[model samples]
Target: MHIAPLSPDDPSELGGYELLGRIGQGGMGQVYLGESPGGEPAAVKVIKPSIVDSETRLRFAQEVEILKTIWGARIAALLDADPEADPPWLATEYVEGLDLSRHVASHGPLDALLTASLGATLAEALATVHKQGLLHRDLKPANVLLGPNGPKVIDFGLAVFAESSVSLTAANTVVGTPSCMPPEQANGEKPLTPAVDVYALGAVLLFASTGHAPYRADNIHLLFHQVVDASIAPDLSGAPEELVPLLTAMLAHRPQDRPALDDVIRRCRALIEARGLKVAQARRRLTNFTAAPAHVLDDLLAVDRPATPGSTARARAGAADVPPGQGESEPEMLAPEAAQQEPGGFRPDRQEPEPPHTPPMPPAPVPRPTDPRLLFARIDTPTPPPAGTTTDEAAVKPDRSRPSARPAPRGGTGTGGGSSAPRRSLRHSAQARITAQRLREAYAANSPF
Candidate 1:
């Protein structure tokens, strides 16, 4: 199926699912390609705004409840639904294949054995549906999907529980495709049985074999008239002789005359076995022959990661963050000043290569002196005095009159080449003060002393 891009009027999200594209549209609403929270693909059917009234909502909710009871591989299982939502919608597993109608239209009719196998599979699927006390009121070629596994029935828009009392359609109003409808349904009969689906299946098989419905009319009225007429027989000229008897019985005018679903399956399997084709072999052939085109299946399974609207354009324009290893080239780290000058925080410039055979540069020398007193004096005054000033005046001016109690240096000489204790004491006091000041600065700066 052709999945068209989502239109401006279509919502980007319903519930929590991100609607990817519009897969198809029907009388009730549009079917969109959506992704679940866990990233699984789903077909989300949104009810039309015109049908969001109380009656339709109730019908849709009932359909959801009926679908919950159904469980089988042949049918597209309902994964989620929100009936109370504005324009209520339901989600189902997205089958990656084309509908049976489109498949047969594109590829010619199936052979006798393949047709029998197809009939058996559909019969079993309908049997499962009937077992759940549910009637797929709308069973047609469009509702049958051809996937990798085999044929799968989809779209329960008109499905109803057999025991339910609600009647969504008006009295004497007909639903479902006319050509595929049984005489009772065509005549607007109530309380439809499972046999009606068997009749429709026969019509579907007829279409598959002959490339057209058993009864075809240009207008709905004429189609309904032809379908309601019991005297008219379905044209099965193109159907295989082996399938003709079964197909005729299935399309019998009277619902009671139509063979039961179990009987239909038995007869189909017998036909396949008589043709020397195992049931499994025939199914494989049917699946292979009626499979959707490779490109179509690829499109259905090709899931793109969900992104916000306009994210694609932003990613293409390099406005979004590029994942680590996806960049064209690794970025080079720059100096603090250089990095600040760039547009973004990181620098985009590449580093230059060094010259060959060059000697490595030596590390810079430390500025600290061996003597603690000289280091303290440097710390006290980072800047030097005038160039012509004497060492005493430039460095430190001590009061010589004050006497020092401490001993002199080990060599019996002070730092300034004097033996005076007072000058030494003053130097020691200045050093002690400088050390204390340095420790306080380090503590305030949160740095190691």
Candidate 2:
């Protein structure tokens, strides 16, 4: 796996584990390379702040519980998690090797014997997950890590308890990669069983042996249709001759038609033995063939490089965007008594840095007043009286811009200037109307002119 430099926005420490760099990021959250206080390596996955709604939190908590119950040699083990953390995060054993997708893309497809070993190893892992009443809903080449031992499956973000009555996704929304998705899942089939994973394993093996999935389409919709169509069989064109029958059965359109996980494991083991190597020996061979050199990973991580100023700016900027009432508290240093914590392992040594204060967004600045002459020019423009109103009537109307024409100054009410008052009022009213009209026109045209 390529270790990418952490961005300014990424948290340096989560749940007490010091995050070294980012491993990968997606719509859900980011995965980082972390080191525990005792120096154990971990892959920490933290949920994104934007998606930390109630439902997403519940799902994340469920994933933590599920991971706790799962234990197998062919899967990355969960090390720590905090569902109630600011954004919530979980850490797993950091498998130090390239993923299946990258391995194949760089070095080419594996031979039939190695492909069988991969299938057998992953099939066993799925079997363990199924025993715990959960389903790894999303299994693809990218999720499998080729460590020193064997192929280990990772990323259980899409896993769900296999309850027939429960719906895993929202209405009309299906998850999982299209290329590796089984027909039942693509169709939103109910009561999803273990066979879905079996089908995915077949696709992974096919990719290993042929460097492509059974079905291919440029559009996601077309791919879904092909996966769901019973008539459109998977294309096993370049697959090894010995593995075609197993793959075809595994890729069957109907879930019930797919082979059981135990059967799949048996077939893969049989294939390995037929090639004159025990399953154990073949697994070791697969690892040796695909393991990346240590120097490559060290360079990718840039372990000795110091943090740059740009990264700190990014961190501060991200902290400023955090909303009130959702501020993250600094993690506390581990105490001797807290060493054996359960749900989330490891105590933090230092408090998380206080997020930089964010000033309230100022109201959009009002447009600065233009030249005073321009304002007078708009007001001076002539305006016609309203329809059906005589010019005299319009002039007599009240002019709010100036004091009301007083009651002839309470004495000598001989209509002094009274005749001129109406004309003055009319001019003011007309100017007001003209000014309003011009402003409306300016606004409609999206300019101050």
Candidate 3:
């Protein structure tokens, strides 16, 4: 927010991607929208060679060389980059939706389902990056892209590895957005484990649900004090009931205290699917309304804004066909039919799948986590799905006959806390809710985020 907007008035050039218009600028650098000779679009980040230094640029160039080896749709595609080029430039896929920070500011806090869906997706993406032996040292709202497929995590310029950097001194140089950063990051500590990303994601979910971070201040020093000492919990009054548990586990102070990315995705996705079922009902009840701007200023109350265009539009249109007054608020307990079910719950995402199921495009997982930290593959790579499990399970029509199993995270690191077990099981969403509730109760006694 401190930086000025990158305007079209300036016509600068970098390598092959001709700078079309300035996108925006921050402390570290300025980004411009550009297009290749093939007319493919790209977001080119242009940073001063002096600010980052020749040695830094070379180090970064090496990262770019490694980035070329990666291929994933969820991640912004890295077309071309030049660290050795004057002022240094990195270009990634030009995603259409606004960045998470801009999206939140313009649209206000995200609805429960949207936030949960995004949380799950981002965790999966992070897992992919970590698996490639690369460390995304900086992860914040600005780096996440909101797309029809879900949230696409962007920016790997700050990526480091066990061999990439010679010193842990990189952390002390001060990178990362302060508010969303974890305690270890804000304190200038080095050799940060994957836990830091978990902590950051938790903080992001908090911001999405509550529209505020764990702490805030004009001065970075003060913010760090609050992050380190105050233990000030976020006010979750605005968060959905089911997501509280996952958020609390993510924001745990100690690195070990936080859940791994895979668990984070599993828990968040379960909550999302549950809320998605209700969105069907919510769509029906949105009577007596007018079209609003793409941006929403008020989202604290879970207001039913009309769905966005594209795939979501079709989904919402179908959902709106449900009759009114069918039900209100989530059930305090499952109905008799739900109780009689196999896992004993309402599982819309699972079942045999009915007709007209809208599926999201599958994105490739991040290539690998390069690194100082031990990167594990089973935790992030896509499993040859179990027998009878189709590659596109999540996209299937609503089916209540079969019980719901937790959706597997498509990308991101798997929980590697040992014993080769996921930090969380893809259990029934309802059971996960029960477990989350207990965790939330414990967190309530201790902290809110």
Best by lDDT: 2
Estimate, for each residue in 185-284, the C-alpha lDDT of model 2 and write its tens digit: 8887777888889899899999988989989999988998898998999999899899999999999887889999999989999998997878987776
Q: Model 2: residues >4 Å from true position, as ranges? A: 295-449
179-247 per-residue lDDT for model 1 (tens digits):
888999888777788888999999988887777888888998888888889888887888878788988
Compared with the true structure, the alpha-carbon lDDT of candidate 2 equals 0.67
Per-model C-alpha lDDT, please? 0.66, 0.67, 0.54
The predictions' CA RMSDs to the true structure, in order, are: 28.8, 28.3, 21.2
- In the range 158-263, model 3's lDDT, one tens digit per residue, is 6676234354234357677778787776776667788878888877877876778867789988887878763576445667677788877887777888898888
lDDT of 3: 0.54
Give residue 353's lDDT in candidate 1 (0 to 100): 13
State in Å the error of residue 378, model 1.
75
